[model samples]
Target: MISLLFGAGASFGAELHKPVPPLGNYLFDKLVELGGAFAELPDDIKQEFRLHGFEKGMLSIPNDSRVINPLQKEIAKYLSSFKPSNENAYVRLFRSLREYAKHVNVITLNYDLLIEHAMLMSGAQKVSYGIDANEKSYSVLKVHGSANFVPVLAPNIIFEGNVSIGCGAFIETNQIRSLNSHEEIIKWCDSRQNSDLSPIMCMYNKEKRVVINPKYLESKRKDYTGVISNTRTLIIVGVKYIEHDNHIWDVILDSAPELIIVDPYPSEEFLLLLKQRNITHTLIRDSFYKSVLKLSLHIRSRVKIDPQI
Candidate 1:
């Protein structure tokens, strides 16, 4: 089986227009561009983001800060606006994988829905998350949650204590199962008066903590392991192998599949890590846009040589 993993770089390459979503380092800038709540953030907070990365910087702040809610919501709103061109790299890659539909599994750490859009454009029947599927569907697992995965706040159910203990908000996985339309996402984001919902953005720390329900996260992890374990060829596009994401790295190292990493400039640290692990991998020193085209051609050539493959 073949598995595909994508990161922020993949989304950046798939942008249909200018101001391609900034990477983690430039996140604060993007948030600033959005103005409103983000604009009100103190200079120290912005400096912290610049000094440390997004995850570490976010972790420095208290979890219950008022800014957290608006931060998550604005991020979702900004990312939702990103649309991939009809014939983008993701579409080309999906088209190449069409022949091996059942044997393929896709996992993305990005919050954008570009993958879904591209899959549809590539003639995929449906996009399934985790274990849920139809025979024609392709599994598109989002390990770092998604722009559409909104947390639903539970009603006030406080226990009688010295300090009012109340039930916290949680994500309804069932709600995600039923979110089959763009209208549903619009409703969630556009509900200005309703503070009951908030977007579940990407990872901000090593603990993998989020305000949403834990079951949903567990489901994603289980599905990720199942895919990686069986992956013969793991095609990674635009992902940075950072220390904070060791959980993801642990699975890849344990599986130790043949790796194909696509990026313009592969990091030396990443190359060294792969070497230290004694895992065989190919580095495609090109942008995802160009690399995916090459990948598609390679796939086509292989099929022509042996149709049975």
Candidate 2:
């Protein structure tokens, strides 16, 4: 079966005019709102948010600082609060795809609830989020965790192992910044270990804590690997090929599936990289929503001819 993998850009067309903020802007605004010192912050840091890509902005966060760590937490909080409306163009596209596919699985790296909202609006009677033993209809796997998901809390900092810093404060690793506190929680989410860490968490409840555990990492790894092993065709939307996310490239390399990449302005380096890897990919120099619409027509025409055989 074919799998649809979505990047943040896939939903950008719909969110262009909406109140939803990008990662860089979201983080920067939250930091300033939380009474952090943004006045002395470097110009480069502000510019980082304006970058055309997601990874560049996300990775710009400092690794071992309390400021960035807390900022990560705030970012997760912001995403959770982002309520998606059904009026967006991408939402309509999602509805159309669901109606056509009927039983196909969708895997998305975006943290937004655009896909989920679309599914609900489309009247898909049966829908599953992750690995479901009894699910038979369509499913959506948010590889990077979604803003709507509430993660399970763990006791005594499970994954990071209780380590204290010289300042007498506990130090959390970057992985903690990526996953929740409980390993089992992430396992339940079916997030891939090698997948880019999505910052989605439930921070509204004052009593709820975050857990990032081994099971979570393993689950994420398993989901990604399973998709790579099983999928025959992969449609990548709104994702730019960045060096930091080479793990995705690795999956593409190993899977050797027919790839269709949809982007408005693709880089020459990305095209060169695909050629270098000997991976076959069709670059659509158009909006993802438009490309998907065109692809859907072709897919339907092809499906119509199957019964004649």
Candidate 3:
């Protein structure tokens, strides 16, 4: 099976119209510019952050409890605020994938719903999360979580501490976040008073998207782990390797499939790491949309050469 793993960079073209950079960088840059306790963070953290550059500053903020909630909101808003363009080649790009690679799946590290919106806009029969399926269409396994996802309450389950929504609850994908058919989710969430009803957004492996879960829940991981392990070709877009995402890194190393990385500014350190691990990868030094278009052209040519394919 083919898997598409996207990072914040995947949404750069869409978010640029918002007049800011990708969601993660915008938040991190804002926080950094604020110049308070955030600026006073350890030198070790700051030093490591310098290696990844601005776009990756989001990774530095995830573990720090003070910024997780704000980070989540910024990510969600940046994602939901932007509507996918009919003219966007990515919509066509993904549509082609669904048509060509019937068994394709998407694993996004981003909290944004851009992929979901694009798929829905392209008239997909179903855009499922994790194990849930319509069987007729594609699935997206959000390793972090989604902005529209909601918590599933369990009455019999008992938990005493750190329940962001309510005790004994787990997150489930909400089919819709917009109140109107044409309204965007960011607008919908902004107008709503009860933001808690929305799924919590965070970076860790947990049920809540809003905070770091110490529980390390297995059910939370089962679907993504299963999907990733079987990935024959993994297309990674705009991700800078970071320590917080070690689990994701583990999967990538273990899968070690045909790798395609999309980033205009690729990391040399990351390239060295990949080389050390002996993982073969094709580095596409272009923006997400353009790189996808290039790959799409190659696939189209192959399809033409073999009519049976």
Off by over 4 Å in 2: 20-69, 85-87, 99-103, 131-137, 154-211, 301-309
Residue-level error in angstroms, candidate 2, position 38 = 7.9
lDDT of residue 96 for candidate 2: 58
Off by over 4 Å in 1: 15-19, 131-135, 151-186, 192-194, 297-309
lDDT of 1 by residue, 28-143 (tens): 77778767666777888777777987777776655542455556767776776666675578887887767666655688988777888787777878887763433367668898
TM-score (C-alpha, index-matched) for candidate 1? 0.84
1-309, model 3: which lDDT tens digit per residue? Answer: 666777777777433243323444345445456464346656765654556654444445534333444444444554455556765545766666555545556777776666776777666776776644343665677766666653333544322222343323333332322222223445434443333333345542222333423232234456667777887667777776774556677877777776778778888877887888888788888876667677665455533233232
Number of the top candidate by lDDT?
A: 1
The lDDT values for all models are 0.69, 0.53, 0.57
Number of backbone-clashing residue pairs for each candidate, in the order shown: 0, 12, 5
lDDT of 2 by residue, 1-309 (tens): 566777757776445456653533344555556554332346676576456333354445443333333444444444445545666655665555554554345787666666665665665665566644122255677655555444333444333223222322222233333232234333433343312222343111121112323344346556876876677777778776665564456777677777777778776887887788788777778775457566565345433333221
Give the winner by TM-score.
1
Q: Please tell me which model should have the higher TM-score, number 2 or number 3.
A: 3
